[model samples]
Target: MPTVLDRLNLALHYAMETDERVTMLGEDILDPYGGAFKVTRGLSTKFPKRVLTTPISEAAIVGVANGMALRGLRPVVEIMFGDFVTLIADQLVNHSSKFRWMYNDQVRVPVVVRTPMGGRRGYGPTHSQSLEKLFLGVPGLKVVAPNALGDPAELLAAAIADDDPVLFVEHKLLYARPLLEPGKGDLIDFQVEQTGGAYPAFTLRPADSARLTIACYGYNFELARAAALDLLMEHEIFVEIVLFSQLSPFDLAPLFSSLVRTRKLLTVEEGTLSLGWGAEVAARAVERMDGLRVRRVAALDLPVANAKSLEDAILPSVQDIVNAALSLVS
Candidate 1:
C-alpha cells in the first residue's frame, strides 16, 4: 500500500537496521528536510553514526562514499538531482566502477547511487533530466529504475547488498503517486505483475494478444501504460509492456519471447533520443532477432523547458507512445 517513495524509505531503514555497515551520505538528508524529496528523512536521527551529511559538492560526496565502500561498508548515496550525476561521473565511472575488477575481485564497491530523474514538476533543464542512459555504457555499474508496479524498496535492498555499484534511478513525478496497476485505478493495491530473474524486468500483458510490445522503465512508464490501455480499449490493440527494475546486464529473453508473438517492438524512455537507452535495446534486439521491427519513443534532443507546455512538447507522452505503436502496427 506504500508509495514508491515510501518503499524507498523503508528500504533504507531496512538496510541500516539489518546491516551495521550500511551507511548513507547526502546533503540536507537529515530530519525535517529529509532530502530534495524527503526520501532520506529521519535516517540521520535513527542511525546517527551511519547517516552523515556532506557539503554541496557532488563529486566529494561520491568520492567519500566510494572510499567507505572500498573499506567494506555498504554505502547508499543520494545525489539530489539526476542532472548532478554528471558532476560525479569521473568518480563513479573511473573509480567506483573499476575498483572491483582492477583489484581482481579482492575488493567490492557495493554502493547504491540513488538520484531522482524526469521533469513533470518543471524544475527547469538543470534539475530535471533523465540522464540514466548516460550511465548505461559504464562497464561495471548496474543501472536500475523501478516502476510503479515494482517495489523500489526491494530493488534498493538488492542493490545495496550487491557486490558491484548500482545506479538506482528514481523519477521525480513518481514520488507521491500510489503504486497502481499499469492501467488500473489508484485504489488497486500495488502488486508486482511479473517477477524477473537475472535482469529483473517485469512484464504486464493486459490481454492475451501481443500485437505490439512497449518496453520502458522509470516513471515515464505510467505514460506508456496509459497509452497501451487506450490502444487496447479503443482501437482493440493489445500491447504487452515490460518495465525494467534492472537496466544493466539486460536480459533480452523476455523481450525476445514477447517479440516472437508481437513481431513489433516500441521502446520508450524519458532520456533524449541521441544514443538513448532505448537505442541500445533496439540495436541488441535486431542483432539477435531476425525479421524484427523496432521503434523508439524518447525525449527530444533539447534542454527540457520549465513551462508545462514546453516540457510536455519536449518529453515523451501518451500520444507519443500511441503514435509510435500505431506506426509499428500499420
Candidate 2:
C-alpha cells in the first residue's frame, strides 16, 4: 500500500515508462541521491536515458526544459526550492509561458516545473518564500498548489497531459503526510488503514451564521481548518474555509458565491501580505462581488528570519486565524 507521495512517485514512474517523450531534469534527480526530497528516487535507474541531472543553475534547468518542450518532449523540471525559481523567471515567464501565443499557437510547451515551497523548520528567508503570486500574473502559465497530499498525483498527471506550461508547487510540509492509494485492491485497503483516518475533502460555502469566509491554500489549509474548529468550539461561530488548490487562472465563481453568502472574506496565506496571493484573492473577491468586506491574514511584508521565534511571528498561526475570524463575527 503506497502513501499518496508514494503513489505520486509511482505514477511519475509509470508515466515515464510508457511514454518515451516523458522525461525529467533537475539538480540531483539521478540515482543514488534520488531528488533533494526523494520524489524522483529510483527514476534515473528505471529510465537511465530519460532522467537527467543538471547543474545548480535554475535558469539552465528551465531553459533546457523549455527547449525540450518545444521539440516535442514533455519535460518535468524540478527547481530544488521555490525561492530559487526567481533566477529562472526569464525563461519561465517570458519564453516558456509565451511561446504558444507569441508563435501563434505554432508551438506548445508541455512542461511541468515542480518546486517545493513554504516555510517550516526555520528554513529562513532565502528558502522560505512562496512565489506563486509572481507566476500567477504570467499569461500562458497554469499554477497549481495542491492542498491535499493525494491531489498532486492526479493534478500533476493532468498538468503533464495538458499542452501548456504548468507550475506545480508542492509544499515541503506535505511530503511525509500519508495518502490513500487510488483504486480498489488489497493494497488500497491496507493503505487506507495506514492513513489512520479519512482524508479531509473541503468545500467553500456561505454560512447563514457565518461572519467571514477564510480563504486559504497549501499549509494554510491546515491552519484554517484548525481555526474553524476552534471557532466552532470556543466561540460558537462558524467560519467557512475555502481552500484554493489551483491558484492561477483564478476561479472566483465559487469564491464569489461564498462572498455573497458570508458578506465578509478573509484571505490567508503563508506568504507575505503585500502583493501576495491573499491580496490578489481579496482584490478579486471585492472586484467581482460588490460590497464585500474583505481582509487578509498573511506574513508581514518583511523578509522571514532564520530564527524560529521570528518565523513563527511572521507566519499566520491557527490562533491568529481564530482571532481574526472571531473579530469578523463579533
Candidate 3:
C-alpha cells in the first residue's frame, strides 16, 4: 500500500509524462532536496527540463507560473507551506484567476498551486495553518483538499487537467497515510462509494443504521473518523462520514443525501472557528434542510502554538468531535 505522498508523486509523474505542456516550479524542489516534504521527490531527476528549482519567493513563483500559463502551458507551482499562499494573493486574485473571465473567455489559465496545511506536527504559528477558507469565495479559482478516505492521486491528476486556477491543499499529516483501497479488510461490512463530478467525493456508511453524519476534509477527517468509530463502539452511534475532495464549488449532494438518512450533522475542520468552511456547511444545511440540527467543531481563533499542549488546546480534537456529536444527536 502506498502512502498519500507516494500517490501524489505518482500523479505528478503521470501528469508530466502525459502532457508535454505540464511544468512544475517550486523552491528547493531539485533532485537532492526533492521538496520540503519530498512530495516532489524524484521529479526533477525524471524530467530535468520541465522541473524548475526556484528562489524563496512565493509571489515570484506565482507570477512566473501565471506567465507560463498565459503562454499556453500548464504550470504546477508548489509553495513550500500553506501560510505563504497569502504572499501570492495578488497574482492569483488579480491576474491568473481573472484571465479567463476578464478577457471574455479569450484565454485560459490552467495553473495549480500546491501547498501543505494543518498543525499536528507542532509546526507552530506560521508553518501550519488551514487557510483554504480564505480563498474559498475567490472567483475563477477552485479550491480542493484530499481527505484520508479518497484517492488524492486521481484528484491531483484531475486538477492538473482542469482549465482553471486550482488551489491544491494537502494536509501535512495526510501525506504519510495509506491510500484507502476499495474492498479492503477493514471496510468489509461498510459500503464505500465515490461520487463523480468536477470534485470527486467519497462516502462511508456502516452496514446497520447511521445515527449521525460527519462532514470533513483534509487531515481533520482522521480525528473525525476516530470519534465516529469510538461513538459507534461506546454509545451505539452509527455515523456516516462524507469526505470532500473539492472545497470551493463544494459538492454537497453526498452531504445532503446523508443528511436525509440522519437529520443530525457535525462538521469538523482544522481552521479557526469564525468564518470557516464548517460554518459554510452549517449555513447551507440551515437553508436546505427543514428541522435539521447542525453543529461545527473547529480550532480556536488564535495562532497555533509550537508546544504540543498549546496546539492541542487550540485545535479541534477527537474529544471535541465526540462531545459535539453527542450533543447534536441528543
Whole-model lDDT values for every prediction: 0.85, 0.77, 0.89
- In model 1, the clashing pairs are none
Residue-wise C-alpha lDDT for candidate 3, range 1-330, written one tens digit per residue: 889999999999999999989999999999888999999999999899999999898999999999999899999999999999899999989998899999999999999999998897988999988888999878899999976577788889989998999999999998999976666745555688788885777788988889888999888778877897789889988899888889987568899999999998899999998999988888898789999999999999999999999999999999999999999988
- How big is the positional error of residue 149 in model 1, measured in Å on the Cα after superposition? 0.6
Look at candidate 3 and give me any clashing residue pairs: none
User: Model 2: per-residue lDDT, tens digit, 1-330?
Assistant: 444467557768877987899999999888899898888999999899999999898998889999999999999998999999899899988999999999999999999899988887788998988877788878998887766534656667777787989898888877776652333321221111111111222343323356678877777776776777677768877666666667887765656655776888888888888888877888887778788777788888878789999989988888888877767766
> Mind sharing the TM-score for model 3?
0.97
Local accuracy of candidate 1 as per-residue lDDT tens digits, 1-330: 689889989989999999999999998898878888999987988998988888899999899989999998989999999999999999889999999998898999989899999888879999889989889978888888877776777788888888899989999888887776444572132223566553377777654567988889888778887897778777888788877778876666777777887889999999899999889999998998888998999999999999999999999899999999998999
Ranking by lDDT: 3, 1, 2
Worst 10 residues of 2 by lDDT: 189-198
| Candidate 3 C-alpha error for residue 283, in Å | 0.7
Query: What shift in Å separates residue 166 of candidate 2 from its native position after superposition?
Result: 0.7
Candidate with the greatest TM-score versus the true structure: 3
Better of 1 and 3 by TM-score: 3
* Alpha-carbon runs more than 4 Å astray in model 3: none
